[model samples]
Target: MSLIDELVALHGVFAAGEYSYRGDRFSYKGHVSEEHARMASIMCRATSMGVHMQADIMAGSYPECGVAPAGGWVVRGPQFTVCVMANVFCFLDNQASLNAVMSILRTRLADASSDLI
Candidate 1:
């Protein structure tokens, strides 16, 4: 089966707001919104991995604001962990060049689609 197929199989699992897949597990962190849940479902479906799909609630910007980081060991409290954040798109240019580049990068890097909102 395709990776997306595998991920979609877990729609119920992710929509429930917290689940584990492949090896990465994600918790929704707060009250789950439909937008977050749907986006999370699509990401996992495309990547066959779980992801944290919560809002960026840190002083107007969230660390890891851009595309889900390429898997790395992030030590928050001395424990190394693999984390992914939803990719951010900056529509700064009138031609939308920045967003376009990011969209391509996301597709190439994570095998995920652009989260155009």
Candidate 2:
């Protein structure tokens, strides 16, 4: 099965999708709307950019400045938690299932990045 399929197969995952850095959704599965997925990607990218900018400004001078890097982000609500990493987003209901889902997405993102090198 595809990665998106695998993502939705995970326990507690209700929505999943792949989006572009420009906030355009390529594909999505589950109950999430394309608009929501696109917005999530844009928000995460913006946050990541801000973090990188701050890190660059403090680079060299502060050794610990870049220690905490922004990558993926998780926003938890009362019934669901949204995870945004790179261009992938997943909505999960159980916090306990986050670790497994995150691991899968991290590996997928890493593999995709390596292809660009």
Candidate 3:
């Protein structure tokens, strides 16, 4: 299914560039930033190239709320940006089910960010 179709299946509220999964909301503002869109876009392209998987904008922060950022949540499946500044880039991992692949993604992102240092 297409991203839009996959997104609708989640019963989320969709808008110009945002979506909410459950009570935990995600917007194209604050932490998520445009990075989410960028990531989703990458996932979409990869999926199109035989990377069977799911993609969404994951939540990043909520310190005062003391919520596990891993419960990071998601936006709709339509692959859209959240904001520009990440505040902090958090992700809800796939429960160690894909540890090997996840490690690489983390390393790449970290290495990519070295330019910012």
Candidate 4:
């Protein structure tokens, strides 16, 4: 199965998608609409950029902080959470799903370049 399909098939995952650094939606699966997915891509790209910037700053200042080369990020809310790795995004319902989803994403996208800015 495709990565998107695999993620959506996981329990508690309601949506999954992939995008470019330019915020272009590549593909998506599950419950979100096309419009929302596009918007989500933009948001994810922007947030990832910000995260990398912060990591860079931390690395430069601390040198041994181990914050550089960020792998991914997560935004948690009371009822939902958004997990992002490389250019892939997944919407999950709980913390348990978050761990499973991130593990899969980190392993599957291990070689995905994070230098796209």
Candidate 5:
């Protein structure tokens, strides 16, 4: 199955896509509108940048930084949750299931050799 298709098949995934770091849509699958996907993409990119910046600051303080910054994040709201990677995002309604869902997505995307990170 296709990457987006596999992502959408996850238990709580309602929308999934491949988008640029600047929020331009390359492709998408599932029920989300183009506008929503782009919005999520933009948010993800911003958050990712913030995370890396923080990591950089922390690294500067340490003589030997062993851990790197997170490449992705999950944004949880009352209504939905968004999972974002370097070039992909997925929407889910159940925050309680986030860990499992992300694990599945990560494994699937890795196996498929897609640029999800």
Candidate 6:
């Protein structure tokens, strides 16, 4: 199965996807609709860019602060949590699944480019 498929199949993961840095391309599987996936891609790209920008500013202002080279981000909600690594996004129902999903994403997508442009 594909990586997104594999992630969606994992326990507590209801949806998973991959999006381009530009937010123009994406693919997803599981309970999400196509339109939702597209919007998610755009949101993910914007959020990732925002994080990178914050990290850049932090690194420049505080050299000792190791916020540069952002690894990923997470949005925890009452019902679900969205975990993003590289360009991949996973919507998990339980926080318990975060570690496993992040481990897989970090290993498999280690080479993924995070360039903003």
Candidate 4 deviant stretches above 4 angstroms: none
lDDT of 2: 0.69
Provide the lowest-lDDT 10-residue window in model 4. 19-28
Reference-based lDDT, each prediction: 0.33, 0.69, 0.28, 0.86, 0.70, 0.84
- The TM-scores, one per candidate, come to 0.20, 0.69, 0.21, 0.92, 0.75, 0.89
RMSD after Cα superposition, model 4: 1.5
Write down the RMSD of candidate 6 (Cα, Å): 1.6
Q: Write the per-residue lDDT of candidate 6 for residues 51-94, one digit (tens) a residue.
A: 98898899889988976777789998898899898888988896
For candidate 6, the per-residue lDDT at 50 reads 88
lDDT of 4 by residue, 62-103 (tens): 999977878889999998999999889998887456778988
The C-alpha stretches of model 2 lying farther than 4 A from their native spots are 35-48, 51-69, 112-117
When superposed on Cα atoms, how far off is each prediction in RMSD? Answer: 15.5, 3.6, 15.8, 1.5, 3.6, 1.6
Q: Candidate 3's residue-wise lDDT over 1-117, tens digit each?
A: 432232222322121122322213433322334766445434433332221111111223333443322212222223442111111222222332233323433443343321111
TM-score of 2: 0.69
Stretches of candidate 1 off by over 4 Å are 1-30, 49-117
- lDDT for each residue of candidate 1 in 1-117, tens digit (9 for 90 to 100): 432233223312221233344324444432347566556544544442222332223313656566343321111223211123233211121222333333433453464443421
Inter-residue clash pairs, candidate 5 = none
Clashes of each: 1, 0, 3, 0, 0, 0
The digit string of per-residue lDDT tens for model 2 on 1-117 reads 887899999978988887665544457798767677666566665665565566556765776764434446677888888786666778889654888998988887764541101
Q: Model 3 off-target regions past 4 Å?
A: 1-32, 51-117
Error of 5 at 72 (Å): 1.4
Model 2 residue 117 CA deviation (Å) reads: 14
User: lDDT (0-100) at residue 75 of candidate 4?
Assistant: 96
Model 5: per-residue Cα lDDT over 1-117, one tens digit each: 876787788777888887665454557787878777667667776776787677667778983885344456678888898887656778888743788667866776554322323
How many pairs of residues collide in model 6? Answer: 0
